[model samples]
Target: MNNKIGDFKLYLSHELGLADNTVMAYLNDINHFYDFFNNKNMQVKSTDIVNYMNKLKSDGYSIETILRRLSGLSAYFDFLIKERLIDKNPISFISKPKGWDKLPKFLNFDEVDKILSIFNTNDPLEYRNKILIEFLYSTGCRVSEILNIKVSDVDSKRGFVRVVGKGNKQRIVPLYNKLVEILPSYYNIRHTYFVKGRDTGYLFLSRNGNKLSRVMCFNILRDACERAGIRKKVSPHTIRHSFATHLLTNGADLRTIQILLGHSNISTTEIYTHITDNKTREILTQFHPRFRNRGKS
Candidate 1:
């Protein structure tokens, strides 16, 4: 079973082109299933698969986790069928789990303002951190994409920045006027840290002039959030989530947000609608004439 799982991993990587993390997740889920069936000494069937899912629920696994594991099993069964080890995919008959629509965590506009305001200082490092946070909110790029940005990626004249996203795909995201105004200061300070001979084109850099790692970016945002008295866990992704949510609340369409965020599918972009719906409900509850007149009627 372990050798068969290794082959599946290779197929996922070489044939499906899945990311490393995704491949590992699939493997891990399948390994769990394998362990559950190890002592059964019976042919795996749809009933067996259903029992496994029930076990997951009984063990207090989240709906999302159960759904993900089911998906992994589906793929694994398909591979087994292709290799003639299974006559049919047992997972095919199972209805997928539903109603796990948890929205992404995002900071509200005031919270974002508070975090950014904490860096209002003359320190160059503070300026860099401020620019990093601002840029994440402005462009909605993933932290990995942002870290890959070069000084040349900024088009100050045209007010846009080019971002290379997942699958090495590139897209242009518009920069707000505020980001444009701060660009010069960030650039000047960023260049001062450059080694005399090493010309790293990456926009954000470390103290030693190396490209900024994702962990470092998370630390920057976490520190800023702490200083701003925000108790929620904050990272570069929180800023990106805030970017999309704020845009949707301000009336940007889902398609436009999808394009800006470089999402391959609009379904991925629609999560922001949940946030917008909550905002709409808040507005209606607070100021709607019907709500205000309910006591009188």
Candidate 2:
């Protein structure tokens, strides 16, 4: 079983071309499943897989986690079947967990304004942090994608940034004039952090001249939110959510948002529709003549 799992890992890495983190996550799920079945001395079967999912739910795992584990198990079983180790894929017929489409949390424009305005322009680090926040909101790029951006990726003349997304997929995200205006100032300050030979082409760098990490970006936003008196659990993704939500609110079509966000599927971009639906409800309740005075009835 252990050797089979090892082979699966290699397959995921070499054949499937999954990212390192995704591969590790799948491996972890498979190992946990194997441990549970091994301890029970039970042959892996459809019923056993169902019991495992039940166990996960009993242990208070989230719907998302359970579904992700099931997906991993399904993939693993498919591999096992292909290798003639397993007769059938037990998880093949399992349905996706319901209520997994909960709306993502996003900040309002007022809250975003508070966060962006909290930084003092005189302080270089704060100014840089401000730019980071603005950039996240302006382009709606993922944290990983933005952190991987190089200085050369930006086209100031054309007002776009080339972002490398998941699976090394590249997309061009347009930059707003507001973001374009602040970038030159940021580049001037960014150069001062360069060491003699340690400097890299990354757009955002730490004082040590290395590329800023994902955690560093998280902490920057967390601190900014704290300073801005926002109680919501804000991260870089919150800014991204706000970006899409606001665009939808302003009548940006779903297909256009999909392109901007680099989503290959329109369904992923359709999540913003829920937010827009709620906003529509609010507008109708406040201003629509038929909705007025309905509470009196």
Candidate 3:
């Protein structure tokens, strides 16, 4: 019953149904705690928990990082308590650091157009890259989900694609017909030229015909932004945020967006409401007479 860190990982993966990435993160955090405990030869205590957190903060971890690490410890201690390994949760006494509430970064529609229009479709790679950017913005898919797509997943006739999201849950997101039109151009090249034993099942691929990596997509976005003359920081997520924001601004329902984005929790999708509210306020400020503050005789 006194299983250490290894047992906790199995619990996280099997009992909790956490994804591999989440399980890995939890294991890494607990390993840090176990290492600290072993190094000091001290038993787990509330003070030790606080001290370790303070040490992490002093080591220049951001508030978000500190909170994530603390949250992981809290979950770990909860498991221990349930197993009768601890009488009380030491992490309970640790207060979460105040998280900075910055609005999620997103590009406006014009910014998105500017970025996508940078590519000329003459070259095969350029043609495919243009389609990739269009598909991302049109579908509002996460970069991971986009890259995970298979050629068969796209139902062009239906104007939707079956996307396997977090937890391996599948959802159908509408694919704009305008974006789908680019598929044929890319498909022709993809079909003709490819590396030996390359995967044709994947929807997106590198010049070598292998599936594209996330980092490679990021660099592609960065270069596209530069070509578009956009100075603001941009990433694949920017397109996702832009997709959701544009839909909300044009009056899409919250629930539909949540389903499209494959958010397990609705609260995650609520951030766009805040963005929409801010846009409304700005519009009123610009046009409303009371807020206009015009000069009067």
Candidate 4:
């Protein structure tokens, strides 16, 4: 826990919306640099970074490994600059590793089923988790979006909920059949939560009755994944990713998914193609009008 690493971690998780694995990797890289000064001295200097990197190189780390570490360290410095904790990014001159981009991680239909089914509806918190996962996957919402939903925002009679997305933009997301079926039962249970605060009216509440935090959302999902025996680094984003990818795999078009995801640019939604390219190719071969007959005799 070097100086401000916790703050930097929060910045990465909440501000940047980084995946849990990426956030942990960045913090680990930054912590490694902090450990370089074995005396636990405070720092943010280019010279120390260079010397520590030199030590890593001398220790025979591969170029890919070195570049990845530097990328994370550079991101830390960039966060420091943004936070105004430092006026300059000490590692500003360094280049990030190329081709390091990863496709967003997603669970297939079966894995998603496992997580959804693992929670017993009899337990209140477990029931909440079940509803939480279903709601996220159904809406394809960001964690921030779903966490902000109030009871008033959902119109169960109409079968859709209003979502407030990035930049305070609001959109309506329909509840899928599975979630719609179980919601009334959840609402019955929800009425019994311990109200520790001023009754914030947020739909997702912690046992303590405060609106559930981003970290709590993460931990709940993580614990659920572990129970389901899913080894992939699962986060709330995984649900969102799975929702979009599964939709595409099942023939939902990118434009519709983009609007559902609240992405400002279709290019942002198009990234799901990287994850579902093979499936899409299958879909195209099976159903595309032009693919039905090519050079047929």
Q: Which is better, 3 or 4, measured by lDDT? A: 4
Over the stretch 170-237, how does candidate 4's per-residue lDDT look in tens digits? 89999987788888888878877645548778888999888888899999899999999999988898
Colliding pairs, model 4: none
lDDT of 3: 0.81
Error (Å) of candidate 4 at residue 75 is: 13
What's the number of clashes in each of the models?
0, 0, 0, 0
Task: Write the residue-wise lDDT of candidate 1 on 1-297 in tens digits.
Answer: 456778889899888877566788899888788788784235578888889988999999988788888889789879988888779888888776565666788999999999989996588778888888888999999888898899999999999999877656789999999889878877888888543358688899888888888899999999999999999977788888999999999988899999999999999898888778877988898999997688894
Ranking under TM-score, best-scoring first?
Answer: 2, 3, 1, 4
Q: Against the unseen true structure, what C-alpha lDDT does each candidate score?
A: 0.85, 0.85, 0.81, 0.83
Candidate 2 vs candidate 3, TM-score winner: 2
Model 3 lDDT tens row, 181-274? 7677677877766433756688888878788888989988999999899999888988999999999999889999998998999998998898
- Candidate 1: residue 192 lDDT (0-100): 82
In terms of lDDT, model 1 sits at: 0.85
Q: What local lDDT score does residue 291 receive in model 2, on the 0 to 100 scale?
A: 92
TM-score (all chains, Cα) for each model: 0.79, 0.87, 0.83, 0.67
